[model samples]
Target: MNRKIIITGTTCTGKTTLGKKLAKEFLIKQIDLDDIHFLSNWIEKENTAFVKDVNSEIEKHLEWIVTGSYQTLLKDTVWQEGTLIVWLDYPLNLILRRYFIRTYRRVFLKERCCGENYETLKSTFSSESLFLWIFKTYWHRKRRMHHWKNTLFSHKEWLILKHPKEEQKLRNLLYDN
Candidate 1:
């Protein structure tokens, strides 16, 4: 079967970057879960609608690499259909630094995702902030992956990439294999 990859990790762990890369390498479409979940002004879509849309996308795409860490609504669908789950487990310091830098860049440049733009420093530091979310969920995500790595899903192929070198190695392996 052709692989359907799900790239998931804590916020700012380069899932999007690596997903895009893998998609390009394999010539598959890349789906950003953020694009489906966020609406104008950074508001989250309703859970029911969000799940429906995600399910629709998963069904519509023949082969894809979807990237996100939104487990509350979309995890079950992704885990069920994804042939390989690539977990980007980077250090907290690295994630924190990337979170701040990416947030600053997006805010300063007025870059928008899912029709939302960063409008204020307070918005960037609040409970809703990706930075804080990453810090809050880092260990919990790690633990969940640890548990997941031993389940039926564990028997499926999983690549836990921790560093740039390992990521490159996995990329090479994916292409070679």
Candidate 2:
């Protein structure tokens, strides 16, 4: 198959982790939309610029694994090109556990991300924090993904893994020959 794999989830659902592993196993480029979508200091890239850059990067590689979804902005480009779409719709409790661990490292440990943006405590608990965003969008994103999967994306090949216990199954699905 001509592999144009896309790993998508709301937040902290191991999208990037899975994308990286798949990219390495397939020896294909890993395109992270988050890397392209953020400017320095957590600022978002302009929509036009983000779309242009994402399209350019995707166009550069015929075989690639992509992480993150900006479906509203990129439905015509990346999502359209995906041959295998992996949706990690893990439970909210699992999502929050991952979030706390990640945020602890990023905020307290001062880990840099998204082109030099560091998460501060102020940002961690604030309205704009990823923590808050996760809570706000978890159910919404889940509904959206299911809606898209059953409707707009019904024709596509989808692998929806709903829990961490499905790890072995996931590996077998993607890794076994």
Candidate 3:
């Protein structure tokens, strides 16, 4: 399938994983919004520069999968031109479990992530902790995503996977295609 796809979901709902899998299956470029929005040392790129950089990178590709939860990034022309919007609507418990596991792996394994940043124990417990941020914003993010799905993207084609089984089916289908 030659398509421009965007995968979005709450923290740890596997946006990046799905994006990577789709990219590999389709033999298309994959872009992670976090990589453009966050720099080394966890510094955030300026809004204009971030948008410009993301737009420039995406414009160069005919078919690609981009993943992230940034709504601002969704406003870009690339998103408007996207052929598919995937919403991973797993349950809160599932999302939290994944979040904790991913965080543990990142902190313990010192896994490098967006912009080559590592998740240190100190940072994970600090005011900037992704865990903490998720706790504070989970509901809000869910609501926002729902609103976007019902409104902003109501006209777009979407695959709203709400369970692990559905995700597996999607993977299998993508592989077959």
lDDT by residue (tens digit), candidate 2, 1-177: 667888889889988877887778768899888889988878899999999999999899878888997877988888888888888988889999999998899888887766567889988878798878888888888888899899988899888888867756656766653
TM-score between candidate 3 and the true structure: 0.90
Q: Per-residue CA lDDT of candidate 1, range 1-177, in tens?
A: 766888888888888888888888888888888888888777888989988888888788788888897764665777788888888889998888887778877878776665464546778867777776776889999998878878747766888889656887777767865
Against the reference, the lDDT scores of all candidates come to 0.80, 0.84, 0.81
State the lDDT of candidate 3 residue by residue for 48-155, as single tens digits: 888888889988998888898776555657668777777788888898888889889889988888878988889878998777787787788779777877898788
Residue 174, candidate 1: C-alpha displacement in angstroms: 2.1
Best by TM-score: 2
Clashes of each: 0, 0, 0
TM per prediction: 0.91, 0.92, 0.90
Model 2 clash tally? 0
Model 3 bad stretches (over 4 Å): 169-177
Ranking by TM-score: 2, 1, 3
